[model samples]
Target: MITPGSNITDRFAIVREDMHRRYGQYFYADTIDALLDEKIAQAKATAKIETFLPVTVEREVSSELEQRAEAAGRSGTARPEILFVCERNAGRSQLASAITHQAVGDRVFVRSVGLNPSGGIDPQVLEVLQERGVPTGHMYQKEIVPRTVHRASVVVLMGVDEVPGIPGDRVVRWDIADPAGQPIEKVREIADDVEAHVKNLLDELGKTNFNAA
Candidate 1:
């Protein structure tokens, strides 16, 4: 059973073995363990709840490593990147980002941020996501990087009035309710709305470019 209390070193070994099995090209014995440890420790330090903590750590750390591995193997290109922004950065922004990442994958570089960051991502949001099978491990962004606003091809505003001086053509705003402090059922309703918006955005993105990866 997955638990928050699983042995850390043992979990690291499991992640290493799986990384090798699935992505051995990305796994280097001398470096991968340390990288994984760094990521897991970071997650442990930031996570608000311990539920399925090890699973969350493994999924997120592996994705970060995978992106690095893939980037190291290829030339750079200016892919369409979507940046989701909100005040708290923990709930609505993250849920939108996560759905976008899953729905749109390598077709776009996806990120989310907050104006005033919250302590870790909201745990209730994570709980609602668990019910949707969307994997809530990677919404760990705690700060809104200014460069993210400049770098994005599209900026999505959630439950925020506005971001000053962002081009009108590049910004999209949704009127969905915030996910923080809402009951699980209400949050689930919000998740459904976010998923619908994600699907609409994906359609607007055109057909996926399999070659982008």
Candidate 2:
């Protein structure tokens, strides 16, 4: 647990050691450390309970490293990567990524990012996602990172304009409404719309056995 005046250096060292052991072969030590700093900084900015910051940073770094490995064909079976992007990762992109994960599981790698990330997830969005049985444990508002863009097989953009890092062929726009401040009923409607798009995308990707209703 991080507290005011607590020596964060030790905690960060532990996280760095864990990551190095897991991804030392695939990525440079400098790269791992840089990402560790980035994740910690991001997590600290919005963490409700400072105690969970280390755990959150570790998980975020591991996810990024795993995606990097898969993108470079260094990991095991290469799963199709899907990245969902919106203005703020608090609503639409979160729904899309969570719904897609609930549908395909690990058979396809899923990520969500914002052009300009918000401080947290939307409460109404959380309610709708829980109603659909999608796990919200790993969900967070993340700013789009370069490597995350470069690795995606498909990038779904919603309510946002150009993503300068990714190729045109990989981008797909969804006209779904953003649920940031909408009523619960409207958020549900948006969730249904997101689910429909996710279903079709999984079908197109040949991962047709979707479990997301």
Candidate 3:
């Protein structure tokens, strides 16, 4: 039980006790206090009811912390990386990587490579993503470094015919139509398909609790 001592507000007492009961073994009082402060700060502007603020903040912070703890536990194992490859870096591969990154955050190690090594991302693809409000974080230069393919748990081959298909259950293809240099309508179609596919893949792989990026 927590007493609302001189420094501890009744709200803090409730939140602290709840979190301590839930995760005190994994975190110390000072650390949990810091987390509580951060969570409250994050929710300060929200117009939600006051009666449940502590509960809501505690739930969100605890969930995020639990996920981080689980990821830390798997440090001994090689990170479960997902590699996305396509003919060029501009379109489908980037879209898939961006969607997956957004859904899983850093929970899965995501790397995208282009066999053809295009120097720039396609404008139409960027336009579509912007319309949908997806953040395409860090557009990396595309290159087929041998090490990435060898380390990936799942290697996805997107619409790129030049490279020979990698044979294995771990390697799959999206069969999405390449949108590079395509008309805006065509690019939009490819984007929609990629979004759906990425969502499904995240749901499927989330069972394994992908490494938090």
Evaluated with lDDT, which candidate comes out highest? 2
TM-score of 1: 0.59
Candidate 3: minimum summed lDDT over ten consecutive residues — where? 1-10
Model 3 C-alpha RMSD to native: 15.0
lDDT of each: 0.69, 0.80, 0.67
| Candidate 3: Cα lDDT at 110 | 71
List candidate 1 segments past 4 Å from native.
1-77, 146-149, 165-169, 207-213
Please estimate how well model 3 matches the true structure, expressed as its whole-model Cα lDDT.
0.67
Sort the candidates on lDDT, descending order: 2, 1, 3
Expressed as tens digits, the lDDT of each residue in 1-213 for candidate 1 is 333355655555556545543444344555666766787778779988755566776787668777887888843444566778888888998888777766655456677778888587888888877776676765686564322343567788888886745432478888899877899989999998988777777667673422110
Compared with the true structure, what per-residue lDDT tens digits does model 2 show for residues 61-125?
99989999889988644467788888888999999999998987767767788888966899899
Two-way TM-score contest, 1 vs 3, winner? 1
Instruction: List per-candidate RMSD values in Å.
Output: 11.6, 10.0, 15.0
Model 1 C-alpha lDDT versus the unseen true structure = 0.69
Best candidate (score: TM-score): 2
Instruction: Name the runs in model 2 displaced over 4 angstroms.
Output: 1-77, 146-148, 167-169
Q: What clash pairs does model 3 have?
A: 106-212, 106-213, 107-211, 107-212, 107-213
Q: Can you write out model 3's per-residue Cα lDDT over 62-140, one digit (the tens) per residue?
A: 7877886687772234335577888777788888887676666545667777777766898888888777777755666
| Ten residues in sequence with the least summed lDDT for candidate 1 | 204-213
